[model samples]
Target: MRSLTGFRITAQRSGVAIAGTAAALLLLTSCAGSGEPAQEAGAAVAEDCTPLHEFTTIEPGVLTVAAMNAAPKFHALSDSGPFTGIDATLIPEFAAENCLEVKFKPMTGAAAQLDLREGKSDMFGGLILKTPERAEVFAQTEGSILYETLGITSAKDAAYDTVDSLQGKRVGTLSGSYYVEPLKAAYGANNVEEYQSDANAFEDLKAGRIDAVAWQSIQGFNFTDRDDDYVTKILDDDQKYPELTVLLENNWPHTKGNSAMTAAIDDYYERAKADGTVARVLEENEIGEEAAELYVNGR
Candidate 1:
Protein backbone atom coordinates (compact mmCIF):
# COMPACT_ATOMS: atom_id res chain seq x y z
CA MET A 1 0.00 0.00 0.00
CA ARG A 2 1.20 3.56 -0.79
CA SER A 3 0.88 6.40 1.71
CA LEU A 4 -1.07 9.05 -0.10
CA THR A 5 -0.97 11.53 2.73
CA GLY A 6 1.25 10.10 5.47
CA PHE A 7 -1.06 7.09 6.07
CA ARG A 8 -1.29 3.65 4.48
CA ILE A 9 -3.96 0.92 4.83
CA THR A 10 -4.67 -2.74 4.06
CA ALA A 11 -8.16 -4.12 3.52
CA GLN A 12 -9.78 -7.54 3.80
CA ARG A 13 -12.87 -7.27 1.63
CA SER A 14 -15.36 -10.11 1.35
CA GLY A 15 -16.47 -10.68 -2.23
CA VAL A 16 -19.53 -8.76 -3.33
CA ALA A 17 -21.74 -9.75 -6.28
CA ILE A 18 -21.86 -6.29 -7.78
CA ALA A 19 -21.78 -5.98 -11.55
CA GLY A 20 -18.33 -6.95 -12.89
CA THR A 21 -17.12 -7.74 -9.36
CA ALA A 22 -14.99 -10.82 -8.87
CA ALA A 23 -16.90 -13.84 -7.60
CA ALA A 24 -14.21 -14.04 -4.88
CA LEU A 25 -11.07 -12.20 -3.76
CA LEU A 26 -8.58 -12.37 -0.89
CA LEU A 27 -6.63 -9.36 0.43
CA LEU A 28 -3.05 -9.06 1.70
CA THR A 29 -2.39 -6.43 4.36
CA SER A 30 0.36 -3.78 3.90
CA CYS A 31 1.56 -0.40 5.28
CA ALA A 32 3.80 2.64 4.58
CA GLY A 33 5.01 6.14 5.77
CA SER A 34 6.51 7.54 9.03
CA GLY A 35 6.20 10.72 11.09
CA GLU A 36 7.03 12.44 14.39
CA PRO A 37 5.32 10.78 17.36
CA ALA A 38 2.18 12.67 18.46
CA GLN A 39 1.49 13.99 21.93
CA GLU A 40 -0.65 12.11 24.44
CA ALA A 41 -4.32 12.70 25.33
CA GLY A 42 -5.04 16.08 27.00
CA ALA A 43 -1.36 16.92 26.77
CA ALA A 44 -0.27 20.09 25.02
CA VAL A 45 -0.12 19.63 21.24
CA ALA A 46 3.67 20.00 21.40
CA GLU A 47 4.25 17.64 24.35
CA ASP A 48 6.25 14.49 23.64
CA CYS A 49 4.31 11.23 23.14
CA THR A 50 6.70 9.10 25.24
CA PRO A 51 4.42 8.74 28.28
CA LEU A 52 1.51 7.60 26.08
CA HIS A 53 3.83 5.18 24.28
CA GLU A 54 4.92 3.71 27.63
CA PHE A 55 1.76 1.60 27.65
CA THR A 56 1.80 -1.76 25.79
CA THR A 57 0.50 -2.05 22.24
CA ILE A 58 -0.11 -4.91 19.81
CA GLU A 59 2.99 -3.72 17.93
CA PRO A 60 5.43 -1.28 19.46
CA GLY A 61 4.93 2.24 18.04
CA VAL A 62 2.49 0.95 15.45
CA LEU A 63 -1.27 1.25 15.92
CA THR A 64 -2.85 -1.58 13.92
CA VAL A 65 -6.57 -0.87 13.57
CA ALA A 66 -9.25 -3.41 12.63
CA ALA A 67 -11.99 -2.12 10.34
CA MET A 68 -14.74 -3.46 8.09
CA ASN A 69 -15.78 -2.41 4.59
CA ALA A 70 -18.61 0.16 4.63
CA ALA A 71 -17.77 2.21 1.57
CA PRO A 72 -18.12 5.85 0.43
CA LYS A 73 -17.95 6.91 4.05
CA PHE A 74 -16.23 4.24 6.15
CA HIS A 75 -13.80 1.88 4.43
CA ALA A 76 -12.75 1.60 0.77
CA LEU A 77 -9.92 0.29 -1.38
CA SER A 78 -8.46 2.66 -3.94
CA ASP A 79 -5.49 2.64 -6.31
CA SER A 80 -3.40 3.64 -3.31
CA GLY A 81 -4.83 0.71 -1.35
CA PRO A 82 -7.15 0.38 1.67
CA PHE A 83 -8.02 3.48 3.76
CA THR A 84 -10.76 4.72 6.06
CA GLY A 85 -13.45 7.34 5.62
CA ILE A 86 -13.64 10.49 7.78
CA ASP A 87 -12.73 8.75 11.03
CA ALA A 88 -10.19 6.55 9.32
CA THR A 89 -8.56 9.50 7.61
CA LEU A 90 -8.09 10.92 11.08
CA ILE A 91 -5.96 7.88 11.99
CA PRO A 92 -2.82 9.45 10.63
CA GLU A 93 -3.43 12.55 12.68
CA PHE A 94 -4.42 10.40 15.60
CA ALA A 95 -1.25 8.39 15.20
CA ALA A 96 0.86 11.51 14.81
CA GLU A 97 -0.72 12.95 17.92
CA ASN A 98 0.22 9.81 19.84
CA CYS A 99 3.67 9.38 18.30
CA LEU A 100 2.80 6.23 16.39
CA GLU A 101 2.26 4.90 12.87
CA VAL A 102 -1.18 3.71 11.67
CA LYS A 103 -1.83 0.43 9.89
CA PHE A 104 -5.12 -1.32 9.24
CA LYS A 105 -6.30 -4.93 9.05
CA PRO A 106 -9.64 -5.24 7.36
CA MET A 107 -12.17 -7.96 8.20
CA THR A 108 -15.82 -8.65 8.76
CA GLY A 109 -17.21 -7.52 12.14
CA ALA A 110 -17.08 -11.09 13.45
CA ALA A 111 -13.52 -11.47 12.22
CA ALA A 112 -12.59 -8.08 13.70
CA GLN A 113 -13.86 -9.25 17.09
CA LEU A 114 -11.76 -12.39 16.82
CA ASP A 115 -8.70 -10.34 15.84
CA LEU A 116 -9.25 -8.06 18.82
CA ARG A 117 -9.69 -11.02 21.20
CA GLU A 118 -6.49 -12.68 20.01
CA GLY A 119 -4.46 -9.41 20.03
CA LYS A 120 -4.04 -9.09 16.24
CA SER A 121 -5.64 -5.64 16.30
CA ASP A 122 -4.73 -2.93 18.77
CA MET A 123 -8.06 -1.13 18.26
CA PHE A 124 -11.25 -1.12 16.20
CA GLY A 125 -13.94 1.33 15.10
CA GLY A 126 -15.79 2.53 11.97
CA LEU A 127 -19.55 2.17 12.32
CA ILE A 128 -18.94 -0.29 15.17
CA LEU A 129 -21.76 0.08 17.72
CA LYS A 130 -21.31 -0.48 21.45
CA THR A 131 -23.47 -3.47 22.38
CA PRO A 132 -23.77 -5.30 25.68
CA GLU A 133 -22.05 -8.38 24.26
CA ARG A 134 -19.20 -6.28 22.86
CA ALA A 135 -18.98 -4.24 26.06
CA GLU A 136 -18.26 -7.54 27.84
CA VAL A 137 -15.26 -8.17 25.62
CA PHE A 138 -13.78 -4.73 24.87
CA ALA A 139 -13.27 -1.33 26.44
CA GLN A 140 -16.11 0.36 24.56
CA THR A 141 -16.20 4.17 24.67
CA GLU A 142 -19.25 6.37 24.94
CA GLY A 143 -20.80 7.71 21.69
CA SER A 144 -18.03 8.75 19.35
CA ILE A 145 -20.53 9.37 16.59
CA LEU A 146 -24.33 9.29 16.66
CA TYR A 147 -27.04 8.06 14.32
CA GLU A 148 -30.54 6.58 14.53
CA THR A 149 -31.62 3.93 12.07
CA LEU A 150 -33.89 5.19 9.32
CA GLY A 151 -36.29 3.35 7.03
CA ILE A 152 -36.82 3.91 3.34
CA THR A 153 -39.28 2.82 0.67
CA SER A 154 -39.86 3.58 -2.98
CA ALA A 155 -41.07 7.08 -3.80
CA LYS A 156 -44.05 5.19 -5.13
CA ASP A 157 -44.69 3.70 -1.67
CA ALA A 158 -45.58 5.11 1.70
CA ALA A 159 -43.35 5.20 4.81
CA TYR A 160 -43.73 2.53 7.52
CA ASP A 161 -44.83 4.08 10.82
CA THR A 162 -44.39 1.35 13.44
CA VAL A 163 -42.67 -1.91 14.31
CA ASP A 164 -46.04 -3.69 14.15
CA SER A 165 -46.58 -2.20 10.69
CA LEU A 166 -43.49 -4.10 9.48
CA GLN A 167 -44.63 -7.38 11.01
CA GLY A 168 -45.54 -8.92 7.68
CA LYS A 169 -43.72 -6.65 5.23
CA ARG A 170 -40.59 -7.54 3.28
CA VAL A 171 -37.61 -5.50 4.51
CA GLY A 172 -34.08 -5.35 3.13
CA THR A 173 -30.58 -4.39 4.40
CA LEU A 174 -26.98 -5.47 3.84
CA SER A 175 -26.51 -9.12 4.64
CA GLY A 176 -25.13 -9.69 8.15
CA SER A 177 -25.45 -5.98 8.87
CA TYR A 178 -26.07 -5.06 12.52
CA TYR A 179 -29.63 -4.29 11.42
CA VAL A 180 -30.39 -7.84 10.19
CA GLU A 181 -30.65 -10.11 13.27
CA PRO A 182 -32.60 -7.59 15.33
CA LEU A 183 -34.94 -6.84 12.44
CA LYS A 184 -35.35 -10.58 11.95
CA ALA A 185 -36.20 -11.03 15.62
CA ALA A 186 -38.85 -8.33 15.33
CA TYR A 187 -40.08 -8.78 11.73
CA GLY A 188 -39.34 -12.48 11.38
CA ALA A 189 -36.25 -13.76 9.51
CA ASN A 190 -38.35 -14.78 6.54
CA ASN A 191 -39.45 -11.19 6.01
CA VAL A 192 -35.93 -9.72 6.09
CA GLU A 193 -33.92 -9.88 2.86
CA GLU A 194 -30.18 -9.31 3.27
CA TYR A 195 -28.00 -8.30 0.34
CA GLN A 196 -24.26 -7.99 -0.22
CA SER A 197 -24.45 -4.22 -0.58
CA ASP A 198 -26.71 -1.36 0.51
CA ALA A 199 -26.75 -0.36 -3.17
CA ASN A 200 -28.26 -3.71 -4.03
CA ALA A 201 -30.76 -3.47 -1.19
CA PHE A 202 -31.87 -0.04 -2.36
CA GLU A 203 -32.06 -1.28 -5.93
CA ASP A 204 -34.36 -4.09 -4.87
CA LEU A 205 -36.50 -1.67 -2.93
CA LYS A 206 -36.76 0.55 -6.02
CA ALA A 207 -37.60 -2.44 -8.17
CA GLY A 208 -40.47 -3.29 -5.85
CA ARG A 209 -38.86 -6.55 -4.80
CA ILE A 210 -38.67 -5.34 -1.19
CA ASP A 211 -41.14 -3.26 0.82
CA ALA A 212 -38.62 -1.07 2.65
CA VAL A 213 -34.90 -0.42 3.11
CA ALA A 214 -33.45 -0.30 6.61
CA TRP A 215 -30.17 1.59 6.94
CA GLN A 216 -28.09 3.91 9.10
CA SER A 217 -29.82 7.28 9.19
CA ILE A 218 -27.17 9.01 7.05
CA GLN A 219 -27.33 6.13 4.62
CA GLY A 220 -31.10 6.49 4.43
CA PHE A 221 -30.65 10.16 3.66
CA ASN A 222 -28.18 9.29 0.93
CA PHE A 223 -30.46 6.69 -0.65
CA THR A 224 -33.87 8.34 -0.29
CA ASP A 225 -33.71 12.12 -0.06
CA ARG A 226 -31.28 12.22 -2.95
CA ASP A 227 -33.93 10.69 -5.16
CA ASP A 228 -37.20 12.44 -5.94
CA ASP A 229 -39.34 9.32 -5.74
CA TYR A 230 -38.03 7.89 -2.51
CA VAL A 231 -39.10 9.20 0.90
CA THR A 232 -37.89 8.48 4.48
CA LYS A 233 -39.33 8.03 7.96
CA ILE A 234 -37.23 9.00 10.99
CA LEU A 235 -38.22 7.14 14.13
CA ASP A 236 -39.21 9.46 16.95
CA ASP A 237 -36.85 9.99 19.93
CA ASP A 238 -39.14 8.00 22.23
CA GLN A 239 -39.36 4.97 19.96
CA LYS A 240 -37.29 1.83 20.40
CA TYR A 241 -36.32 -0.02 17.27
CA PRO A 242 -33.34 -1.70 15.63
CA GLU A 243 -31.74 1.76 15.48
CA LEU A 244 -32.08 2.44 19.20
CA THR A 245 -29.10 4.26 20.82
CA VAL A 246 -27.02 1.20 21.61
CA LEU A 247 -27.01 0.08 17.98
CA LEU A 248 -26.76 3.48 16.30
CA GLU A 249 -23.90 5.24 18.05
CA ASN A 250 -20.24 4.43 17.23
CA ASN A 251 -17.66 3.92 19.99
CA TRP A 252 -13.86 3.85 20.07
CA PRO A 253 -13.29 0.35 21.40
CA HIS A 254 -9.75 -0.76 22.15
CA THR A 255 -8.27 -3.38 24.51
CA LYS A 256 -10.18 -3.71 27.76
CA GLY A 257 -8.95 -1.49 30.66
CA ASN A 258 -6.42 0.23 28.43
CA SER A 259 -7.16 3.67 29.81
CA ALA A 260 -4.27 5.21 27.92
CA MET A 261 -5.65 4.08 24.59
CA THR A 262 -9.16 5.14 25.63
CA ALA A 263 -7.98 8.55 26.79
CA ALA A 264 -5.96 9.02 23.62
CA ILE A 265 -8.97 8.29 21.41
CA ASP A 266 -11.45 10.28 23.50
CA ASP A 267 -9.11 13.22 23.53
CA TYR A 268 -8.89 13.00 19.74
CA TYR A 269 -12.69 12.98 19.58
CA GLU A 270 -12.98 16.03 21.79
CA ARG A 271 -10.44 17.94 19.70
CA ALA A 272 -12.17 16.81 16.52
CA LYS A 273 -15.40 18.23 17.88
CA ALA A 274 -13.89 21.48 19.20
CA ASP A 275 -11.79 22.39 16.20
CA GLY A 276 -14.62 21.49 13.80
CA THR A 277 -12.43 18.65 12.50
CA VAL A 278 -15.27 16.13 12.64
CA ALA A 279 -17.75 18.41 10.94
CA ARG A 280 -15.32 19.53 8.25
CA VAL A 281 -14.23 15.98 7.61
CA LEU A 282 -17.85 14.90 7.23
CA GLU A 283 -18.59 17.58 4.64
CA GLU A 284 -15.34 16.98 2.77
CA ASN A 285 -16.44 13.36 2.44
CA GLU A 286 -19.74 14.50 0.85
CA ILE A 287 -21.87 13.36 3.77
CA GLY A 288 -24.84 15.60 4.51
CA GLU A 289 -23.96 17.62 7.62
CA GLU A 290 -27.54 18.02 8.83
CA ALA A 291 -28.29 14.30 8.67
CA ALA A 292 -25.00 13.21 10.26
CA GLU A 293 -24.93 15.99 12.87
CA LEU A 294 -28.39 15.16 14.21
CA TYR A 295 -26.74 12.82 16.70
CA VAL A 296 -23.23 14.40 16.81
CA ASN A 297 -22.40 17.26 19.23
CA GLY A 298 -25.56 16.61 21.29
CA ARG A 299 -27.70 18.30 18.68
Candidate 2:
Protein backbone atom coordinates (compact mmCIF):
# COMPACT_ATOMS: atom_id res chain seq x y z
CA MET A 1 0.00 0.00 0.00
CA ARG A 2 1.20 3.48 -0.76
CA SER A 3 1.72 5.73 2.19
CA LEU A 4 -1.02 8.36 2.51
CA THR A 5 1.77 10.92 2.78
CA GLY A 6 2.90 10.05 -0.73
CA PHE A 7 -0.49 10.64 -2.37
CA ARG A 8 -1.07 14.10 -3.84
CA ILE A 9 -4.52 15.52 -4.57
CA THR A 10 -5.72 18.74 -6.13
CA ALA A 11 -8.06 21.37 -4.79
CA GLN A 12 -11.73 20.83 -5.62
CA ARG A 13 -13.33 23.27 -8.03
CA SER A 14 -16.50 23.53 -10.06
CA GLY A 15 -17.18 20.35 -12.11
CA VAL A 16 -14.28 18.57 -10.40
CA ALA A 17 -14.52 15.31 -8.48
CA ILE A 18 -12.26 14.85 -5.45
CA ALA A 19 -9.96 11.85 -5.86
CA GLY A 20 -9.89 9.22 -3.14
CA THR A 21 -6.63 7.52 -4.08
CA ALA A 22 -2.96 8.08 -4.97
CA ALA A 23 -3.89 8.14 -8.65
CA ALA A 24 -5.13 11.71 -8.22
CA LEU A 25 -3.13 14.34 -10.09
CA LEU A 26 -1.41 17.13 -8.24
CA LEU A 27 -2.34 20.63 -9.34
CA LEU A 28 -0.71 23.70 -7.86
CA THR A 29 -2.50 27.03 -8.11
CA SER A 30 -0.51 30.16 -8.86
CA CYS A 31 -1.23 33.35 -6.92
CA ALA A 32 -1.56 36.77 -8.46
CA GLY A 33 0.26 39.68 -6.84
CA SER A 34 -3.12 41.43 -6.48
CA GLY A 35 -2.84 41.44 -2.61
CA GLU A 36 -6.59 40.99 -2.36
CA PRO A 37 -8.40 38.03 -0.80
CA ALA A 38 -8.16 34.93 -2.99
CA GLN A 39 -11.52 33.56 -4.00
CA GLU A 40 -12.91 30.86 -6.28
CA ALA A 41 -12.55 31.49 -9.98
CA GLY A 42 -14.43 34.59 -11.22
CA ALA A 43 -14.80 36.12 -7.76
CA ALA A 44 -13.75 39.76 -8.01
CA VAL A 45 -10.91 41.05 -5.90
CA ALA A 46 -11.44 44.33 -4.11
CA GLU A 47 -9.28 47.34 -4.93
CA ASP A 48 -7.82 47.72 -1.46
CA CYS A 49 -6.66 45.14 1.12
CA THR A 50 -4.19 46.07 3.83
CA PRO A 51 -2.52 43.83 6.39
CA LEU A 52 -3.17 44.46 10.07
CA HIS A 53 0.16 42.84 10.94
CA GLU A 54 3.57 42.40 9.33
CA PHE A 55 4.32 38.75 8.57
CA THR A 56 5.78 36.80 5.67
CA THR A 57 3.83 34.23 3.65
CA ILE A 58 4.83 31.71 0.95
CA GLU A 59 3.72 34.10 -1.77
CA PRO A 60 3.66 37.86 -1.42
CA GLY A 61 0.26 38.85 0.00
CA VAL A 62 -1.19 35.34 -0.43
CA LEU A 63 -1.84 32.86 2.38
CA THR A 64 -1.49 29.54 0.58
CA VAL A 65 -3.54 26.97 2.51
CA ALA A 66 -3.51 23.16 2.48
CA ALA A 67 -7.13 22.67 3.43
CA MET A 68 -8.53 19.32 4.67
CA ASN A 69 -11.17 18.43 2.12
CA ALA A 70 -12.99 15.94 4.36
CA ALA A 71 -13.68 18.12 7.36
CA PRO A 72 -16.82 20.12 6.58
CA LYS A 73 -17.61 20.93 10.19
CA PHE A 74 -14.45 22.98 10.50
CA HIS A 75 -13.83 23.96 6.89
CA ALA A 76 -15.72 22.82 3.83
CA LEU A 77 -14.02 22.83 0.43
CA SER A 78 -16.69 23.47 -2.16
CA ASP A 79 -16.67 22.63 -5.86
CA SER A 80 -17.96 25.97 -7.18
CA GLY A 81 -18.66 28.25 -4.28
CA PRO A 82 -17.05 30.31 -1.50
CA PHE A 83 -15.44 28.54 1.47
CA THR A 84 -17.62 27.97 4.50
CA GLY A 85 -17.31 26.58 8.09
CA ILE A 86 -15.49 27.87 11.15
CA ASP A 87 -11.85 27.48 10.11
CA ALA A 88 -12.75 28.46 6.58
CA THR A 89 -13.93 31.85 7.79
CA LEU A 90 -11.38 32.11 10.61
CA ILE A 91 -8.45 31.52 8.27
CA PRO A 92 -9.55 34.27 5.89
CA GLU A 93 -9.99 36.63 8.83
CA PHE A 94 -6.45 35.82 9.94
CA ALA A 95 -5.17 36.33 6.43
CA ALA A 96 -6.87 39.70 6.19
CA GLU A 97 -5.46 40.60 9.57
CA ASN A 98 -1.99 39.89 8.23
CA CYS A 99 -2.76 41.83 5.06
CA LEU A 100 -2.72 38.74 2.90
CA GLU A 101 -5.28 36.96 0.73
CA VAL A 102 -6.02 33.22 0.84
CA LYS A 103 -5.16 30.67 -1.87
CA PHE A 104 -6.38 27.24 -0.79
CA LYS A 105 -5.23 23.82 -2.05
CA PRO A 106 -7.45 21.06 -0.81
CA MET A 107 -5.86 17.72 0.26
CA THR A 108 -5.99 15.02 2.90
CA GLY A 109 -4.99 15.54 6.54
CA ALA A 110 -1.59 13.87 6.15
CA ALA A 111 -0.88 15.73 2.93
CA ALA A 112 -1.50 19.06 4.64
CA GLN A 113 1.41 18.55 7.07
CA LEU A 114 3.64 17.31 4.26
CA ASP A 115 2.82 20.43 2.22
CA LEU A 116 3.63 22.64 5.21
CA ARG A 117 7.02 20.92 5.63
CA GLU A 118 7.79 21.24 1.93
CA GLY A 119 6.92 24.95 1.90
CA LYS A 120 4.08 24.34 -0.55
CA SER A 121 1.61 26.02 1.80
CA ASP A 122 1.79 28.67 4.47
CA MET A 123 -0.61 26.77 6.72
CA PHE A 124 -3.07 23.86 6.97
CA GLY A 125 -6.65 24.02 8.25
CA GLY A 126 -9.08 21.69 10.04
CA LEU A 127 -9.79 20.82 13.66
CA ILE A 128 -6.03 20.34 13.97
CA LEU A 129 -5.01 18.95 17.34
CA LYS A 130 -2.04 20.50 19.12
CA THR A 131 0.65 17.94 19.81
CA PRO A 132 4.27 18.12 20.90
CA GLU A 133 5.43 16.31 17.77
CA ARG A 134 3.52 18.66 15.48
CA ALA A 135 4.73 21.73 17.38
CA GLU A 136 8.31 20.54 16.86
CA VAL A 137 7.66 20.44 13.12
CA PHE A 138 5.42 23.53 12.67
CA ALA A 139 4.68 26.82 14.32
CA GLN A 140 1.19 26.54 15.82
CA THR A 141 -1.08 29.31 17.03
CA GLU A 142 -3.17 29.34 20.18
CA GLY A 143 -6.20 27.06 20.39
CA SER A 144 -8.73 28.09 17.76
CA ILE A 145 -11.33 25.69 19.14
CA LEU A 146 -11.97 22.91 21.65
CA TYR A 147 -12.21 19.20 20.75
CA GLU A 148 -13.87 16.83 23.18
CA THR A 149 -13.84 13.20 22.07
CA LEU A 150 -17.13 11.49 22.80
CA GLY A 151 -18.99 8.21 22.33
CA ILE A 152 -21.87 8.28 19.85
CA THR A 153 -24.35 5.44 20.03
CA SER A 154 -27.73 4.52 18.60
CA ALA A 155 -30.63 5.76 20.70
CA LYS A 156 -31.82 2.16 20.80
CA ASP A 157 -28.71 1.20 22.76
CA ALA A 158 -27.77 2.29 26.25
CA ALA A 159 -25.76 5.50 26.49
CA TYR A 160 -22.10 5.03 27.27
CA ASP A 161 -20.22 7.56 29.41
CA THR A 162 -17.63 5.46 31.17
CA VAL A 163 -14.77 3.21 30.15
CA ASP A 164 -16.45 0.21 31.75
CA SER A 165 -19.49 0.68 29.55
CA LEU A 166 -17.35 0.37 26.41
CA GLN A 167 -15.54 -2.77 27.50
CA GLY A 168 -16.23 -5.64 25.09
CA LYS A 169 -18.54 -3.47 22.98
CA ARG A 170 -17.92 -3.03 19.28
CA VAL A 171 -16.75 0.54 18.87
CA GLY A 172 -15.72 2.30 15.66
CA THR A 173 -13.33 5.21 15.19
CA LEU A 174 -11.38 7.03 12.51
CA SER A 175 -8.33 5.11 11.34
CA GLY A 176 -5.64 7.75 12.02
CA SER A 177 -7.19 9.78 14.80
CA TYR A 178 -5.31 10.54 18.02
CA TYR A 179 -7.82 8.64 20.13
CA VAL A 180 -7.81 5.48 18.00
CA GLU A 181 -5.20 3.41 19.80
CA PRO A 182 -6.24 4.68 23.19
CA LEU A 183 -9.80 3.58 22.53
CA LYS A 184 -8.63 0.18 21.33
CA ALA A 185 -6.56 -0.28 24.45
CA ALA A 186 -9.37 0.77 26.74
CA TYR A 187 -12.12 -1.18 25.00
CA GLY A 188 -9.90 -4.12 24.04
CA ALA A 189 -8.29 -4.54 20.65
CA ASN A 190 -10.70 -7.16 19.44
CA ASN A 191 -13.66 -4.97 20.23
CA VAL A 192 -12.49 -1.85 18.34
CA GLU A 193 -12.95 -1.23 14.62
CA GLU A 194 -11.04 1.44 12.72
CA TYR A 195 -12.60 2.95 9.61
CA GLN A 196 -10.89 5.09 7.04
CA SER A 197 -13.37 7.90 7.65
CA ASP A 198 -15.97 8.98 10.19
CA ALA A 199 -18.69 8.69 7.59
CA ASN A 200 -17.91 5.00 7.17
CA ALA A 201 -17.98 4.49 10.90
CA PHE A 202 -21.31 6.28 11.11
CA GLU A 203 -22.62 4.01 8.40
CA ASP A 204 -21.58 0.91 10.32
CA LEU A 205 -22.99 2.33 13.54
CA LYS A 206 -26.39 3.02 11.98
CA ALA A 207 -26.43 -0.44 10.44
CA GLY A 208 -25.81 -2.16 13.81
CA ARG A 209 -22.42 -3.36 12.62
CA ILE A 210 -20.91 -1.40 15.52
CA ASP A 211 -22.24 -0.32 18.86
CA ALA A 212 -20.99 3.25 18.71
CA VAL A 213 -18.68 5.66 16.94
CA ALA A 214 -16.03 7.41 18.95
CA TRP A 215 -15.09 10.76 17.51
CA GLN A 216 -15.10 14.48 18.30
CA SER A 217 -18.23 15.78 20.00
CA ILE A 218 -18.95 18.09 17.10
CA GLN A 219 -19.24 15.11 14.78
CA GLY A 220 -21.60 13.41 17.17
CA PHE A 221 -23.75 16.55 17.21
CA ASN A 222 -23.76 16.66 13.42
CA PHE A 223 -24.67 12.99 13.14
CA THR A 224 -27.52 13.15 15.65
CA ASP A 225 -28.83 16.30 14.02
CA ARG A 226 -28.97 14.57 10.67
CA ASP A 227 -30.07 11.14 11.85
CA ASP A 228 -32.84 10.58 14.31
CA ASP A 229 -32.56 7.67 16.83
CA TYR A 230 -28.95 8.59 17.44
CA VAL A 231 -27.50 10.20 20.58
CA THR A 232 -24.15 11.28 22.03
CA LYS A 233 -22.65 11.14 25.50
CA ILE A 234 -19.53 12.70 27.00
CA LEU A 235 -17.20 10.05 28.32
CA ASP A 236 -15.90 10.58 31.83
CA ASP A 237 -12.18 11.13 32.02
CA ASP A 238 -10.82 8.85 34.72
CA GLN A 239 -7.34 10.26 34.19
CA LYS A 240 -6.30 6.88 32.79
CA TYR A 241 -8.34 7.54 29.65
CA PRO A 242 -7.65 11.20 29.30
CA GLU A 243 -6.90 11.13 25.58
CA LEU A 244 -10.39 9.82 24.97
CA THR A 245 -12.05 11.93 27.64
CA VAL A 246 -10.10 15.19 27.83
CA LEU A 247 -10.96 18.43 26.08
CA LEU A 248 -8.15 19.16 23.64
CA GLU A 249 -7.28 22.45 21.97
CA ASN A 250 -7.16 22.66 18.18
CA ASN A 251 -4.92 25.21 16.40
CA TRP A 252 -3.49 26.19 13.03
CA PRO A 253 -0.16 24.84 11.77
CA HIS A 254 2.13 27.26 9.95
CA THR A 255 5.55 26.79 8.39
CA LYS A 256 8.18 25.93 10.95
CA GLY A 257 10.44 28.69 12.36
CA ASN A 258 8.12 31.50 11.26
CA SER A 259 8.12 33.46 14.50
CA ALA A 260 6.58 36.58 13.02
CA MET A 261 3.77 34.56 11.44
CA THR A 262 3.21 32.63 14.65
CA ALA A 263 3.07 35.76 16.76
CA ALA A 264 0.71 37.42 14.33
CA ILE A 265 -1.60 34.40 14.44
CA ASP A 266 -1.50 34.32 18.22
CA ASP A 267 -2.36 37.99 18.23
CA TYR A 268 -5.23 37.33 15.89
CA TYR A 269 -6.53 34.63 18.24
CA GLU A 270 -6.45 36.98 21.23
CA ARG A 271 -8.20 39.75 19.35
CA ALA A 272 -10.79 37.33 17.96
CA LYS A 273 -11.64 36.00 21.38
CA ALA A 274 -11.74 39.37 23.12
CA ASP A 275 -14.00 40.89 20.50
CA GLY A 276 -16.31 37.83 20.53
CA THR A 277 -15.42 36.95 16.96
CA VAL A 278 -14.53 33.37 17.87
CA ALA A 279 -17.69 32.92 19.94
CA ARG A 280 -19.85 34.40 17.24
CA VAL A 281 -18.28 32.22 14.58
CA LEU A 282 -18.71 29.04 16.62
CA GLU A 283 -22.31 29.86 17.42
CA GLU A 284 -23.06 30.65 13.80
CA ASN A 285 -21.82 27.16 12.94
CA GLU A 286 -24.09 25.64 15.62
CA ILE A 287 -21.21 24.63 17.85
CA GLY A 288 -22.27 24.34 21.48
CA GLU A 289 -21.40 27.02 24.04
CA GLU A 290 -19.43 24.44 26.07
CA ALA A 291 -17.28 23.74 23.03
CA ALA A 292 -16.90 27.48 22.58
CA GLU A 293 -15.55 27.66 26.13
CA LEU A 294 -12.88 25.19 25.12
CA TYR A 295 -11.77 27.64 22.47
CA VAL A 296 -11.56 30.36 25.12
CA ASN A 297 -9.63 28.09 27.54
CA GLY A 298 -9.76 24.32 27.37
CA ARG A 299 -11.23 22.83 30.51
What lDDT does the true structure give each of the candidates? 0.56, 0.61
Task: Put down candidate 1 lDDT per residue, 71-153, tens digits, no spaces.
Answer: 43455453223454655665656665455655666545555666787777777745666667777878876647444444444
How many clashes in candidate 2? 1
In the range 1-299, model 2's lDDT, one tens digit per residue, is: 10011111112222221312122111212222212223443332344544566777877767787765543444333432245566766776676545456676655566667888888888877667776678888888764544544545545356666767667789997655666777887888888898755566777887889988877666555566555477666655568777677766677888988888888777777677777777776766766565556445655
Q: TM-score for model 1?
A: 0.71
Off by over 4 Å in 2: 1-48, 70-72, 75-82, 142-144, 147-156, 188-190, 294-299
* Candidate 2, residue 33: lDDT: 23
Poorest 10 consecutive residues by lDDT, candidate 2:
1-10
Worst 10 residues of 1 by lDDT: 1-10
Top-scoring candidate (lDDT): 2
